[model samples]
Target: MSSSIENEYFCDGLTEEIINALAKIKELSVISRASSFYFKNKKTTTKEIIEKLGVATFIGGSVRLSKKKMRITVHMIDTVNDFLFWSETFDRDLEDIFKVQDEISLFIAEKLREYIGHIEIEDKLVEPLNLSINTYREYLKGRYYLMKFDYESTLKSIKIFEEIINEKPNFPNPYLDINQGYAYLGTMGLLPADEAFQIAQPYLKRALELDLSSPRSQLNLSWIECWQNWDLQKAYEHANNALEIQSTDEVYLTISSYLTVEGKLGPAQNYINKALELDPFSAINHHYKGYIYYLQQDYKKAIQFLQKSLTFNSVLPFPPIYIGQSLLLSGKFNEALEYFDGLKGVSLKDLTKLGGKTMSYAFLGDVSKCHIGIRELETYLNTELMGKALTFLVLTNVLLGNYEEAIDYVELAYKNKLPIILLFNTEPILKPIKNHKRFKKIMIQAISDNSNYTPIKRYRHSLLHTEDISKYVKEMEQVMMENKLYLNPNLSLKDLASYIELPTNYVSQLLNQGVNKNFSEYVNTFRLNEFKERVIFDENKNVTIMSIAYDSGFNSKTVFNTFFKKKEGITPNTYLKIKRRN
Candidate 1:
């Protein structure tokens, strides 16, 4: 079910009610409101909707509200065949809104069950809710505001939930909604963590007292336990209790995140997969899945999922941020820079874009530009974004080869318990100093403090072993030479691994240990040789340096010139002049 066009609050409420009604049928696997609502006010294709949600069929409609009347138009789509299986239009007075929603839900459920050959159902699947229309409207408004997820909107939601609680103090749903609103405010960095949690506890306790069976309340409590109290066992217990009542996408995602922080990648993957199965259309779900893959050092798969997440919602900063990081980790430095550059000027307020640009510039060897970004990010340091800003500064320093300063910031992040530091073991930006004694000590301390902490094992084997380094290096070089892989400006570690029939981690290990160089350094060595022989000393001097750089697999003229000067102690043009004069 989807939201209505005219009265988004009412439409969203109706859609959620229908979904909840359908979920009561034990045999049906209903998509959650979080996933289904992702399509609200957006134009999406049927095929895309089906593929993203993993739904066999879907119901879409629009709602129209007049002074005293309501109209709803609905169509059921058979996703497998792209067929409109049923269509209906309803006209009713505003007072009959609940009746209309209930009728519509039951009709759809009956038709769907019949279509699926479950014709002998004994009892009604949907139960009627006992609530006043006015109170229900207030709850809908609260939900509508909560879904916005911004600071002002969350505050507005809280206000509305407070109003509902005042009018009907025993209503558990509004209390739960208030708890969730504060939880989101804190989790999303919209408010001070202490304040948000303080404000949330009373609401949550009231909700649990009102309705102990409510899974959402338990899930909200679980988040508070994990993030605020750092009580992993209590968090797990609450999460499991929520799942016992109802296995919701949000609950699964919550548990998955806890597991992810613990470094239990296998269990994390399983739970996140369950979340995806329940809410496949959710951009957040896909983003996290990509992040998980990134931690696993599966760059190609991570890129694929992150890119898909963008297709679902292009405005999200996470997908682009991680996509650029993944590209950088794969040694596509020029490509990574380009990706970050494309995000510039889209929104000045997006810190993730700034962070990405800062890291990309640093990795591309533009120390000056990187510093400019670092200074810009520093302005956010005292605000609600202190943790994120500090973390980006740490990454920037790492890129600048300032390992000591980076470690200092890492220590600060650890002290602050910044959520970003949770990725200490897997963040590709920290790869340069990952093996350093200081960084390892920080990681060990972090792991020791959290019972859920699981050491990231993606690069464990390659880092621990160094046997047959020469053989691996030889294999890598042979594959590169045979394929002339160095000639491809967009070549990446993953691509090289594919050609060599080796894992990316293995290839990275060979370059770092066996050859005492990184992927970009090794590839640029061949490219520089190619450029000098084929272009600089070529009899035809008419060819341009930039053209030659491109032909020799150097994607950016700036990068080529900088690298060439660094290696040869002269600019490319100067080297050419000196060679010709000699």
Candidate 2:
């Protein structure tokens, strides 16, 4: 695709370098490379690419290499206005390719931060690589085949990547790719999850050995622990470690998945919202966002985002299942049946398909077909030994009105530490039976077993004595009521700690333990109370709501209203009007 002697070696590589650099900035929503480079070599207009990819802008340019010297031209195009934000040309010798690549990537990031809203580009976008062009090309070639996504292509990519590992045993990236290759194989059902993750672990272990601090490496181990070992505790630990290091979309999604299965719907939705912000165009993130809504009983929004996810990738595992369930939950039984039967992307072997068909039949009151689907699901699980599919059986049982059977599965799942047991508390279908004595007992036991991570995962491990926490709570309440520390609009845990003359850790622990709220929640509770008191008073009627809100330490109107509704079950304006009238 190039006329020069060293054609495109730097161009394609440089593009990938730019993508890598930008992806590290969690503030910017950079689509994954597979989605970003989807426009490569295609005669697609900038408008079409941005619309399809749901991006604001993109980087594009060309490279022409004639012997040791290369001429590179690059520009940022704002797809909305269809004009150049910035452009630059570099004429440089190819001897120091790593330096050139890093410099160019950094410059592009600088330009992006300048053009776009405030982006904190503190870290270098691209890392230094000391290697031959051949090694880098081989790595790119493996990536090329890996992205092809076919079985043979993945095998070829894995083989090439392993060869690189043998050649450069110290390099971490190839090992990581191999880990991903096996992960993809497992996710696509080409291999058993156990076998695939087992094969992937050694490579991931090497990656960890090379860079023990890598969040990505920790995330991969988290996946292995969750899916293969069924160890949610260990998985949560590794994932929490990764989250402490990086806030990437992948880390957010994985943590969200764990929280969702654990029936922590509120925190689950919060994490998925973060993921969607960082990778808005990702079908999986959208699917998760929909699933969160479905669990929270918001069928309309559930169906909306699930359908949106399907528009991007029709075959995502969860959306089709949940969209159908959402429709059925809305009493569109016939429509649910039609939708379930019409999905071409769902294979009969998929857990999603199995669960969807069973639930759809049951929702439609087709007892015969429901029983038939149940038999099929049981047979599939018994014959294949799919631990992951066990949750679907529990779901199907619940919808079929087999309360005793459902309870039995919950006990079995709890015995095996199947995370699906955690779902019984929040699962919409299980709402009717949630009060069953045996079910409640099992759920209580399960919850007691799993450590609560919200509020303070770290400080809870090394807690102050109960009396010490209670003493601090008294001190905090006294300080809040008298000094009104919550009046500071920009108050923080550290700031509140200073007012009480306590260590920040002890204050956080006391807030979580004795007060049963985090610092923000505790302060916001006081702020909301203050706002309510002001609004209800007879004399303060003429002031604007936002002005009063600011006086009460609720700086952002959005935050004030959101907290008001979350606590009072009505918008601030509605509450204000009703209170004045009363």
Candidate 3:
């Protein structure tokens, strides 16, 4: 990167934009922003990065933002053969950043056909962020903090995004990102799920009205409908929509959870399996898998997977609660009590801390302690956090042998449209009332049939041969040799592509695959060759090297020297010294 120190934010934002755009293409297995950015500023080989990330290819780049102009030099490398797949340098006005991102994503998709099979690239991914450069910089700052993925950083992101909302109220991304920040807080139990979603819903609605296709928007909206609104059917529908646009572990997990709540365990297992396949080490996926088993009354497998999930992420709030319940359901009362006793400060939620203890004490015949938890829950019912305690209250009553009271709570849960009832209703603790006439009536009333759902069909284009790019490659070479276009200091990929009367993607594909260099490397090779030709002449000897560099189509002094050193393993001055002596 070359610019004021502040442009680092701009550079990060540009990269994230490209990642975001490419991730929208359903067929491409684009790496996450955090995962790919891990190699930034690290001294790592291309093969190591590709293998470590488990990707077939990867893109790397340099960016320069000066005043209103932006330059991005990017390259894609094929991991299998260790060869350059495609690369280009984009030069555009700062406001045209969205256009540049879309162009790169589409071109990459076109080039990746041989590696990943046919991919569908949309016409656009990110909406045009129509803001002053300064405002855009602020938005980037917000995104930078948001990607940190911690409580304090997420809250910081929320505040910054709030400021953007105040200044540029119509920009969809800031609105969407504000929702994302709040969503992280809600899920981590730092904030009440109801409160967090309520705070973000207005902003989220505006963002969706502006652009509903963003992957984050769809996922966030689905969660809101599930957790906040209790509209499980609509939640499943939104999740399906998001998966169709971009199949991610998050979307797959969300669909799995929704399917689980509908008592569709087979489909739920399939979705969760897909989620785990994508992100095998994710603790959340493990937790959901365990929860699915717990619902199936398989207490032993439930405890095993839940314990595995806690090993990955120890502070996760609900796994401990469920593990205790699983232990009790397995008839290990002492183990259940011990597990509940060991949960010192795993969560801030009062219900999570109390539910397991209350149930453990009930089975142990400690009536006083059990009622103490029951009283604490009753008090919670009178507070603003009322929705938090109902699920646990139902389970506690069942464990206390108050099957009738548990049934009453079930009716209340159904009246309030709680989505998790169908799921936990399958718990072994509920076995006594699960088949009761009244319980059966409520079960019928609680679950909505989302089984008829079908996702948006992902269409693939007809395949093309790998050797087909050879024709365009030769045409690009002929155009370059005839026009001496490298002499133009301000040339870009678009300009060269236009001169050859080929689409920009076609020319870039050719240069990257056939010529084996990016646009910057390809053009700079010509200029470097031109520089060498001129510098050796007696007429140019008296002329300064810098002046000859300009005459040879080298634009910036930094770029010229850097490219020369990288290619020749020495500076231009040293190269001139060696050549002139010979």
Candidate 4:
């Protein structure tokens, strides 16, 4: 009898100890048992496993015990072609069971090395496990629970993994698995990026050092570098290295999605294609491919691809929002509205709010309602709503003849680091702003911030004295400082313009051109900055962020927190803790 590597190792009735043992082998890339066992009982074909696990080779075997003796058999299969590379069986008395494990591991490692024409130093260093095989059983149970992906189960798994690791610190797999959990938290945006990276990186680094060719360690490190560090170039290089070492797996596809986020549409598309060839049913690759098309503004093609993506995920809200927008832009207005209606309660606001409403209004030719939606979008932009709202604001403002407002939105969008505007070189909404030197400068800055490209021009203040336009609006920084206008609760662009004896039109233009922000944003950024500074410096004041918001001239604490979190990437309390730590 043998263990199946799934919930049950042996069929019929057999009682042999089953230990999930990985090799102490050095160079061959191995997927960690915890991650690999997820597919143990899966009905997926071998080709599917090759793509999903990204492992080129898979091994299966069974063990049986009778009369105080252990008999074992193992088979090695090539995943890409479903070819059997080797098969073997061994028999040993109970006293020699430990020797049996060591011999089998060494035999497999040496045989593979000779077959592949290279040998690597064994990297596995075993730490003693204090518990019975029952402890290992609990660990496997924890893995099963964690794979269910519920909060409670994950926490249970963490506790189990911690217990195991505390008992065996040198056991590399548990450290790697726990680190994967932290990385998952970071990816889900549940934890702060810095904190998550701090918890995950060291463990992953150690895992790699312990097993330099372990595909799991490489996968985790590459993903952390891409997602947490935002080092796309390094991520690309690491992912390429991992793929070269072992091709046909989920790790490569996961890394390719990062490239898509960076707007490397062509490369991302090609990499995902390779990923799908290895694992044809991977929903993630299809989902990301749809996003690349969406970025390219191919609404029809994007819709088609995204629809196929939905077949892979029928319930994800994000893809539907993209589909709705494509439908609206493609003139299927009623159908678009239906999709929006479908998202009423289920949608995340930042995903659907401004874009859905604005598209609906614009498609219906309800200019007044469209402008109302635009105002709401502006309000959201000034406060904290990001993503599609920012994208819609940048596009809609320009389309609505609000050129100065478009530039202002562009500046704020750039500051927020929205990718849509950063990719504006190919965007059409930017056409109205393209010829204006001010808009060009804003685009350049956005591109630089997004792409880190060289040759980006800085945002310039309005030229008060130009040859064709000899008129000049006096600079407003001193005026703003004198009145403390930015911090004033009742302050508005109109009030500031009136105070300076300048027309509101001229003031708006000057703010966008000179200050590179809309009136609301220009004021809010200063307010938020001041709020942050005071929160740090005024420890004796015993002030809450709410109180600070009012004192700093913000009318709403909600607005204050929204803007604060966006700018700082953490809650006020967390920021305070970080400040205290420093």
Best by TM-score: 3
- Root-mean-square deviation of Cα positions for candidate 3 versus the true structure, in angstroms: 8.9
- Candidate 2 lDDT tens digits, 210-329: 987777788888877765555678888888888655556778888888787677788888888877766676777888898899988899999999998876665555577788889988
Range of the 10 consecutive residues with the lowest summed lDDT in candidate 3: 113-122
lDDT of 1 at 369: 88
Which of the two candidates, 3 or 4, achieves a greater TM-score against the reference?
3
Off by over 4 Å in 2: 1-14, 23-35, 38-59, 63-71, 77-85, 91-97, 110-124, 129-160, 180-196, 224-246, 345-351, 383-385, 411-425, 435-582
The pairs that clash in candidate 3 are none
Writing each residue's lDDT as its tens digit, candidate 1 over 1-582 gives 324433666777887888876765545667988788777657988688778778887888877777678888888876764656567799888777777777888777655643342222224434444667667777888887776545666789989889888888888888888888877765544555556778888988998898777677778778877776666777887887776555567877888888887778888898889788878877778888998999888999999999987777665556777898899889888898788878843443347778888888888888888889999988986776676677788888987889999999888777766545566666766889999998998777664444643322111234426567877778788888888999998776668878877655466656767877766678889999999888755565888888888998987665687679779988888788888898
Per-residue lDDT of candidate 3, residues 265-373 (tens digit): 8888898887776555566778889988998878888888898887765666668877988888888988888888877754444466677778888888899988998
Model 3 stretches with alpha carbons more than 4 Å out: 1-15, 34-53, 60-77, 81-107, 114-126, 132-156, 178-198, 228-233, 280-283, 297-315, 330-336, 344-347, 363-365, 415-428, 461-582
Stretches of candidate 4 exceeding 4 Å from the true structure: 1-231, 248-251, 254-264, 297-301, 313-318, 344-582
By TM-score, the candidates rank as 3, 2, 1, 4
TM-score of 4: 0.49
Residue 562's lDDT within candidate 4 is 66
Q: Rate the local accuracy (lDDT) of all candidates.
A: 0.75, 0.73, 0.74, 0.59
- Candidate 4's displacement at residue 569, Å, is 71
Give each prediction's root-mean-square deviation over alpha carbons.
24.2, 15.4, 8.9, 32.4
